[model samples]
Target chain A: MILAYIGLGNMGYIIAGHIADKLKQDGEPTLLVYNRSNAKVDALIADGKHVQSASIDHIARHADIIFTCMFNDEASKQIIGKDMIGSGQMKHGAIIVEQATIRPDTAEFLASIANEKGLHYLTCPVMGAPPRATAKLLVPLLAGNPAQRKIVRPYLENVIGKVVVEVGDSPGSALRLKLCGNYIIVTMVEMIAEALTLGEASGVGQNKVQELLAGLFAGTPVTDYAQRMTDETYDDVRFSLDGANKDTTYILDLAEKSNADIPMAKVFKNHLDKLTSDYPSLDISGVVGVVREASGLPFNLKKA
Target chain B: MILAYIGLGNMGYIIAGHIADKLKQDGEPTLLVYNRSNAKVDALIADGKHVQSASIDHIARHADIIFTCMFNDEASKQIIGKDMIGSGQMKHGAIIVEQATIRPDTAEFLASIANEKGLHYLTCPVMGAPPRATAKLLVPLLAGNPAQRKIVRPYLENVIGKVVVEVGDSPGSALRLKLCGNYIIVTMVEMIAEALTLGEASGVGQNKVQELLAGLFAGTPVTDYAQRMTDETYDDVRFSLDGANKDTTYILDLAEKSNADIPMAKVFKNHLDKLTSDYPSLDISGVVGVVREASGLPFNLKKA
Candidate 1:
């Protein structure tokens, strides 16, 4: 089976590289790769283990199982909807596995569109950032028809994901799970940011708070994000503020449509919106800067 | 040196028990114990390890170092203020080490009163619930004068706490750190509740979300609280709803006083306030029940 990966951004590039590396270990000739920009594709091809597709349609026409990892619902819709990779372009019974964090409804909508065109679609949005993807440690939340899941399970387990959880038969279930996971992460970021800000404002050293978090609140998003905020190195941008804002918006929209009250999402959305407006280039961890400013501390105060 | 423990709520009882156990191991003759009601004191004395003090004043006068782990600032104030364990009651240079979750200002005020009474004071609020306290795994955030911290560090390290973080020399800094840590935990409980609600509402399984949280958000406040939430067993009240609301209020008041824009804290306080009004007897994890109700689910949906 020809395997392809599209949208070679930070997370996607690392994920695709891992998949390519796995396929190469099995003595596969090459994996198909595509991206809007050429640099990532050029870099992958330069490594000499994968072949770059000329366009998304090239990937659609050639690859049996294609993975798309985009930034948001709009990007996913543009790629899988009529605008690009139209239903007729791909081989019949081709599988489109989506790993982008998008609205559950959008995943269902895209799945329906794929079904009408004789293409099998699966939503398998993953948990973890770029580093985990690079290490092939991303956890996949899988949702599709049982048959479709069976066909994709080997690839997910062997090539891409370390752990794959089958959420349900509905394509949207995986996306919902993805949003739930991202909601935890995003909310955790804001929570830790506020925590550090409160600690600093109250004259508790950030190092002490960081140490306590590492000991008590260790092994989760708390320590990871708290470390970033304490270091004030927001420019590294493993997950960009814009990307985090997108996921938060997706979560809020999902909550509204599902009649769920996620008040923290609303608050987080406002904070991200305000922060992104002020510093569009800042990492999502930069939300700490907003909390610091509110506490009458200079944004990104240097630690003594 | 005579050591005393006051307050015997869920957390305090276990913590005081651990200290008594340590004292017994060290061949110390007795530990001074006090509570408003006689039941807990009776129970501790029934264990045949510790001695019960007649009153808070008795503890103040007899014990060289006293640990107070009350529910709130008012209780702490009453215990150490002029009304109860007054300045003239305790021996000179006696130390009052507070472990209650209270406002930073209250800690400072209590410290000042202790100082005026020729006593040394330290705020050493602990993190963790009853189980952790029982296991002697509680993390303590300690702040006081250098000399006082030195006097108390041996007891903290030997008997009560697994990790002790000296936040600063300022007496209020430790309370602020404790509040910050509790803020992370309380907000995490709410965030996990909202995420679970959103996931369940969007047709994702609660078990799936719980599993994902256990794996990705493991070891932090998220997994422990999310497990309690998904189990719908909020009544095992390790931390009561009222107590959580109290901590949330302390965090919000601290944020406001420090000019920190912790919008999440404001939202969480409102949720806890609403939840406590309805299910005053529920566990803090019952904050999940509030989110579940907001999402139109029953307060405690039985897991299949």
Candidate 2:
């Protein structure tokens, strides 16, 4: 069996590495890799991993399955439509698993095209940060036809994740799950921002409020992620606020399509949009900065 | 020194009981108790407690300090201003400690009124519900003059709360702190509601998302309070959605007055408003019900 991997950004790279590592330990299944940036491919080759350099033709000729983990819906569409669709070396009976956060409609559209080409398709988005993926501590969600899901379950087990929750038998099911997970993250940031601002306004130090929060509400990700708000640790940020803004924006867009009113999420996105102005490179948790600013207090305090 | 404790709500009753119990043990100071509806007063009197047939005026004339733990600003003002002020029975050097969640402006206004009448006023709101207060687990924030705060510290120690967080000299500071604390609570609900909705949309069972969240981000109030959201447990509600909506609406009024932009909080309030419409009698945590509706799923499915 052969596996073709595409997209080598932060999440994609970690996942692809895990895939290569798994294949190596499990009798060395043939691996084919592709990225617009060839540097990643060179690095993998230098690491003594066998990576097949496949322009669309070679990937179709050699690989029994392809995994795509692109940035968004547009990127996923561009990669497949522009690069892979018309490659003359097409093979039948192959399956494609998409592990990217994209719109449900986009996933359905792509799955339809793949089905028309006589290929099985699965939407298998994941839940984790780059570090979590690297540590194999990610959560995976698989959604597709039963046969396509079973085909990818083996390689999925090879990756180090805490869960592989299989959902509905639909192309967009997994992506839908990922988007929902992101909605939670942004919502957490928004809540912390307002709470901290209220604390400051009340003349109770943020640290003191945080202490009480950590004690009573000790089991929520909302408070566990407090330092990200209190410390104003944004510049050297792990998750960019801009990225979160994009996700929220997309979620809102989807909500609009579904006619689901998510005023709370929209309000949070507006705050994120405002925050991006002053701290353009701010972390998503930098929303607390906006809160502090609106509270008319000093952004940061100096140690006495 | 005499102390008059008024209001016997779930939190109020426990805290007053703690104070009366402590004072009885100490045998130095006298404790008088009062409640609206006047029906519960007999029970306190029957317990050999200094339960009084007293109006706010009666309490004012007899006690060196009067502590009010009523429900809202209007109730507090009606009891303190109309009844207490109209009776004209307050002595010079007498102090009033308020322990209700009200607008900061109300606190400041009441303080101004008390000052004009040569009365020492302090806004000292207590944190914790009935169970916590019964165990003396509440956190108290004291906002007043140092002299007035000093006079009440010993008595406050008996029943107010465990930790006396000293805010500042502003009469409104304690109320501000209380509002801030509730801000955190409502914001948390908003985020949890949205996150759970998103997670369900992704085909990850709300229960699975809860499990993953508990493992990854289960160290704060946001997640701890989210147990209701995860488990879909909302029947025996502790804090009703009406209460949450009331608090959010109150805080938004303050935010608007202060000209602070609480777009995120505004969104949260909208969600709570929506929830309040459906589950009019549902607990605040019952906002999860609204989320379930948004996700097009059934909630509270008990395991067989």
Candidate 3:
């Protein structure tokens, strides 16, 4: 049996590396790694494990299971449309695990297309940043057929993530869950940014409020984001403002369709819009800068 | 020296009880407890430690250090304005610890009035609800003159809280920090509500999202709120809607004055407005009801 991981970006690279390193030790499935850039592909197989660089065509035809962490719907479509599903090249009963956070319609369309071609497609978008990915502590939301879920269970659980939340067998359940989860994260960033700004504006400084948060909200992602906001430590860029805004957009769209009122998310998205347009490369924590600037304060509160 | 605790409400009762219990053990100051309702005062002294039930006037005239947790500024003004400070019956060099979350102007004005009367008015607001208070684990934000802070330090730490976060030596600094901290909480409730509603709308169930939250934010108040949101456990009413809205009001007021742009806070306040209107007696977690209604789901998702 063979496994293929297509897309080696920040998260995908770390996740795929773990999969390759562990699967090589198990000595069962040879991992076929593919990336749009040749350098990333080279980096994946640099350790010379059970991993091998494979072309998209070879992955589509030969790989029994393919994991995709794509940039967006367009990128996923470009690769899976022409080379895999449309080309009629994928093996029968081959499973495709989508680890990308895509729109509900895109996810359902892909799932239905794969079903029509005698393939199983599962929406299994993950939650957590690159650090969580590196630690294999990410939470992967899995939604697909029971049989297909069973096939991919071993690879995802202890191999890559701390736990796998099985959303449902429905086509878009996992994708919707992904949007909901991302909604929580982006809104948390918004909340932390506002609190930090309020602290700074009140002459309490961000550090004291951060100390209070440590006492109250320690052992959470809130602390990590709060630390970044307090001292202008956003250059690490664990999650880009563009990606964060995209999820916010997806969350808003879901709210529109599902008839949910998430006004706070809209505001959070607006902040993300300003942040994304300005810094582009800064992490999501840069939302604090927008908040600080509004409070008649410096963008970065770090002391000279 | 005599120690007085002037409002035996939910939080004050627990906090004063702990302080009285520990003070009795140390054989230091005797605690004079007062409350609006006599039954609450009765319950407090029922343990028969170093606690003594006293009239507000007696607490005003003889107490060296006073801690007050009033219902509102109006109530605080009633007790401290006429009965304590305005009466001119209290001793010189007395300290008034304003544990209530009052308006910023109210805090500063109270501080000024107390200063004019030769009293130490410390804006020391405690963080956490009744449970944390009962556990002697509340975090008190102390902002006042250094010597006064030194006097009140022992009563707050270990006796009623885990530790004290000294916000500043400026008037209203503790109050502002309180607003910022509560902003994080209210916005967290908003974030959790929206996330839970989206989960229910997508048929993923609030429990799954709550499980995800436990993994990501277990040690924070977010988990407790997520549990309440998931099961519609707002009936317990840890913090009432009316009170939560009041703090949100103070936060928005501060944001407006500080020139900070907290659009998400505006959205949160709006949802809270709807919440305060509908379930006036429910906990702040009922914000989930508003989100669920918008998502076309029922208010209570708890299984029958």
lDDT of 3 by residue, A1-304 (tens): 7899999999889888888877878887778989989898887667565678889999999988899998998988778755788879889999999898888788888889899999988888998888889889999999999999999989999878978988888858888888888888888888888887788787777788888788888777888888877767788878887788788888888878878777778888777888888889999898899878777887776644
DockQ of each: 0.70, 0.30, 0.71
Residues B1-304, candidate 3: write the lDDT tens digits: 8899988888888888898988888887779988888887888767675788888889888999999999898987778876789988888999999999998678788888888999989988888878788878899999889999999898888888878888888868888889988887888888888888877776677777788888888767888888877767888888888788788888999888887777778878888888888888889888898888877887776644
Model 1, B61-163: lDDT tens digits are 6788888888777888887776444748788888888888888888888889778768888988888777777767788888899898988887878467666
* lDDT over C-alpha atoms for residue A255 of model 3: 79
TM-score, predicted candidate 3 vs. hidden true structure: 0.95
> Model 3, stretches more than 4 Å misplaced?
A302-304, B302-304
Measured by lDDT, the strongest candidate is 3
Tens-place lDDT digits, model 1, residues A99-141: 8888888888999988888888899888887767766778988
| lDDT (10s digit) by residue, model 2, range A1-304 | 8898988777777788878887888877647888888988778778777566666567767777889887777787877644565453557878878887888888888888877888777888877677678888777888889987887887886475856777778887666666667777777667767766766665556776676566556545555568767776666677876578668877887665544445677767777888888778867777776677777866554321
Candidate 1 chain A, poorest ten consecutive residues by summed lDDT: A48-57
Q: C-alpha displacement of B106 in model 1, angstroms? A: 2.9
iRMS of each prediction in angstroms?
Answer: 1.4, 3.3, 1.4
Which scores greater on TM-score, model 1 or model 2? 1
